[model samples]
Target: MKLEKELIFPKGFTVRKVIELVTANERFASKIYFQTKSHQCNGKSMLGLMSFMLMTTIGESYIISVEGEDAEKVIQFWNKFVREIHENTTLSYWEEEGAQTVQEAMCQSISFWNSSVRSVAQSYLKPGKKEI
Candidate 1:
């Protein structure tokens, strides 16, 4: 599977936000990855994104490509993720650090992401199973 979209982060967005987005797609057990002219990172790993120096800024054109078994669902998640960021620029979902430690952040991240995309990924799920 494959798809490409030009996305813009509202403003003040960071690699951490990328981490969250990447984390969301990672849940699908798919072999997803992202790339640009200079960087390519595994969509399923936060470290993969950071280590590749994948970062976003307002108005920058990010040509993102996603592929894998659940690529379509992940792309939908990314679309929803970016739109929500624009709508809530003042309170970017990745914020609200209810997480105090690394482990806590990991747990909270999974929690935040699950809450964000359960609906979009649901179509790929078996009836009543709630996950993709």
Candidate 2:
């Protein structure tokens, strides 16, 4: 079974705070994952959570989905947690995609190619293959 919900946080709530709360409850945290359009992270990892750069701004939405036996309980916990922390926060659906400048594109391209996994798998991974 799985449980899922979408939510936003309060302006004062930081990702670090999220890390503390999520990790504090190991049993619940281990059963869930959080996702946004471009990023997904384990609820229990500070670094993984940081990599998403989650913000408490209006319109940005996050999806919390949990698996395993306690999925319902974990989902309920996160739902209540977000509501309590961000009572007055507005909720909206923000489109997370957009175009970028030529310079920005170049930088992103370089970053992807130079990223740890990409750098190592450059030769092994490619756009297409002729097939056998």
Candidate 3:
């Protein structure tokens, strides 16, 4: 599935809010499919979604690209819920905790690979030879 468009929620969007919205409407939640990250996939877990919130000072928008079997439904529910929340609730923006960037994650993976390769090289080489 692919997102027909990107949906940007206002600054106060949070995982808790998402859960609330989903829980409030059971039909929408039941349709979610677990897929790898993409325009169609949630790419985020329930815990992750619940943890995310907009930053207050900047009031940063949450960018969600909806793609999946139920993307349209989720988007429709979320859009309607956001409008309702804005009008009816006093929202508090919570900052999402820091998460490793793709680059940082890749570097960590490479570091592990390098170390493992060195270890294997050492096992095959003479004691005085370079590990690489």
In model 2, what lDDT does residue 91 have? 31
* lDDT comparing candidate 3 with the true structure: 0.47
Cα-based RMSD of candidate 3: 12.7
Per-prediction TM-score, please? 0.53, 0.55, 0.42
Clashing pairs counted in every model: 0, 0, 3
In model 1, which regions exceed 4 Å deviation? 12-19, 51-54, 91-132
lDDT by residue (54-118, candidate 3, tens digit) is 22222333355555577777767767877776666554322222222322334344445667665
Question: What value does the lDDT take at residue 123 in candidate 3?
Answer: 57
Better of 1 and 2 by lDDT: 1
Least accurate stretch of 10 residues (summed lDDT) in model 2? 93-102
Greater-TM-score candidate between 2 and 3: 2
TM-score of 1: 0.53
Number of the predicted model whose lDDT against the real structure is largest? 1
Model 2 C-alpha lDDT versus the unseen true structure: 0.58
Please list all clashing residue pairs in model 2, or write none if there are none. Answer: none
Q: Alpha carbon lDDT of residue 64, candidate 3? A: 52
Candidate 1's displacement at residue 114, Å, is 52
